[model samples]
Target: MLHRIARATTAAGLMVSLLTSFSARAIASEPPAHCRDIAIPVSIAQGQPARYRVWGQLCTPEHRPAATVQVLVSGLNYSHLYWDFPFRSSQYSYVRQANRAGYGTFNLDRIGIGRSSHPASAEVTLESNAYTIHQVVAALRGGAIAGRAFGTVMLVGHSYGSEIAKLEASAYRDVDALVLTGNAHTVSVSAQQNLAQLGQPVGQVPRLAAEVPPGDNGYATVQDAQRPEFMYNVADADPRVIALDIATKETNTLGELSTIGDADAPGVTALLRLPILIADGADDKLACAPDATDCSSAATLAAAEQPFYPHSPVDAVVIPRAGHAINLHRNAEMAYCTIINWANRALGTPPPSK
Candidate 1:
């Protein structure tokens, strides 16, 4: 089915190749209107019931229902669609590739966004968001197919979603590997320096100078740049991703402890022990301190900062004409292909070379 869809769309020519190469049949199956409109009333500790929705097709390769799953953790404002929501028929190609590689995928819609119930004026915090992810992981773990034929689980998180992924790793041991993009913390100086270079100054710099989060500055700078797919999804004009991004920016501006850091490393510093990969666009205005520092070069002396996850080497690629939305950029396939290759090696299942 996927091959036929690819061939059909491919015949349309290169203009359609971007969406078609990935195949389109996976999302062709219509999710029940009700399925697309989920209202999960989840209780966050003693707080109000957090609402969220789960869209996109969840299945395995061979078009059969397999167990192993690829849970997607979204960025600050981007919703699950960036991960699974398919606009074009060919968008399903990403899923088909994952399935072909022997893994199922789940794109999470964090609370207060998407079809999820939106609490009145209550924004989603990292602690709150992490708890929500914990629930999802726990559910999948108990889903009768986890850790068995499913074997191990892998996590792929972008931006704020990467922060949550670190929290999930700290809280959940079932996660075997992590694939993080633009993953930085509140404390990293690189985040701050990058923000300044972009002509966007963070207000908290004066007060929280002693203990501001590593990636906060950089995250802030990156979020300001608008991306289209995140802004315009057919399902909802205002995708929860936009909401998440807004909520995260607001929270960061408020300077609450949304990070998982202490004196030394912000959350993911210790991930060196785990199989991890951190990739960020060189042109990303947010690329700084904890993400990358200046090497011993006269040129980089000004923008110099070392990476946080020293154990897991950061693949700081210079993606030309790319902004914060590296995944959806014209060269996004290159980035995804890199991460996928790394994941395959980490999972002991590298794909066959062409």
Candidate 2:
């Protein structure tokens, strides 16, 4: 049956070689055709106008210019690397896959994470984060970040990033399409438990202490030992990938976590009038477990989410045997293909045949 074949393909993709010499050589020899680090200045409200820089990397394809640019946003406790993962770059890097599919990618560190400026943790909320993303989107469309302006913009988000995307798209209605991963209307009990225990003050974690500004103790990160349990399905992931994720993990703020569920408010998602793709890993304990949205298959997931997106033509895909961090999983290639292919169809841009 087709279902059986699909499952087999996912399993096989995970079993593919991790670090062959040939892969390393290919990676070293071929970098992105066009890549640049960008810092966009944004002003957000915290009782007064506060200015900060949102950092990101923009990369385009080698042969032809991309017509549609994807603005990638990471989830809680993750940085820009979540979208363009470094380890096993050949299989797990969504940036590489998007470029190969002829789409430009802007992988960003949200205002309070990674290379971006760290404002007082209390100033960083879902609304402020969404406003920051709005500025980035405006900058991209106005040709402020790169010399070239992108007419078609797609917002791609994972987990908490997905929530931000929902808020931005609803509030601004600026993007052409939405690709939301690791998110749904329902939250699993396991996800709540993981969230409740996942974070500790940034100052307490030696690895993250230097990353935050002095006297600001509001940023938090998942404990290194608990990361694999919270974010990955060990059986379907590479051990090296897990180690790399922990080593490169980033911070999330208390403000961001406090209002994380704001985007799920009734009538918010229903305001959008664009093509949307909701993708999640079947084994993602955070979003696909008991009492959460049914992610057993695309149809089931889409049906469950239809009420939330009454104005958009929404499609869903459930990656098999993967966890919360879909891009870091061995079968990430499938997830990449699914997203790129859906974007192509939604935006009317035909992808080059693989």
Best by TM-score: 2
Q: Name model 2 segments beyond 4 Å from true.
A: 1-31, 46-50
lDDT of 1 by residue, 91-184 (tens): 2234545655456676556654454433322234665666666666655666532233455677788776777777667655567777766543
Q: Which portions of model 1 show Cα errors greater than 4 Å? A: 1-42, 46-57, 64-67, 85-93, 120-123, 144-149, 185-268, 288-321, 350-354
What lDDT tens digits, residue by residue, belong to model 2 across residues 1-354?
233223323322332332221233544454365889999988875354537899999999876888889999999889999888887677888898788667999999999888898888898899999999998999999999888899999999999999999999999999999999999888788678766886777787776778787888788887888889878889999999999888888888889988998999878998999888888999988789877888877767777777787777777788888999999898887788778767776899875543
As a TM-score, model 2 comes out at 0.89
On a 0 to 1 TM-score scale, where does candidate 1 land against the true structure? 0.59
Best by lDDT: 2
CA error at residue 209 for candidate 1, angstroms = 34
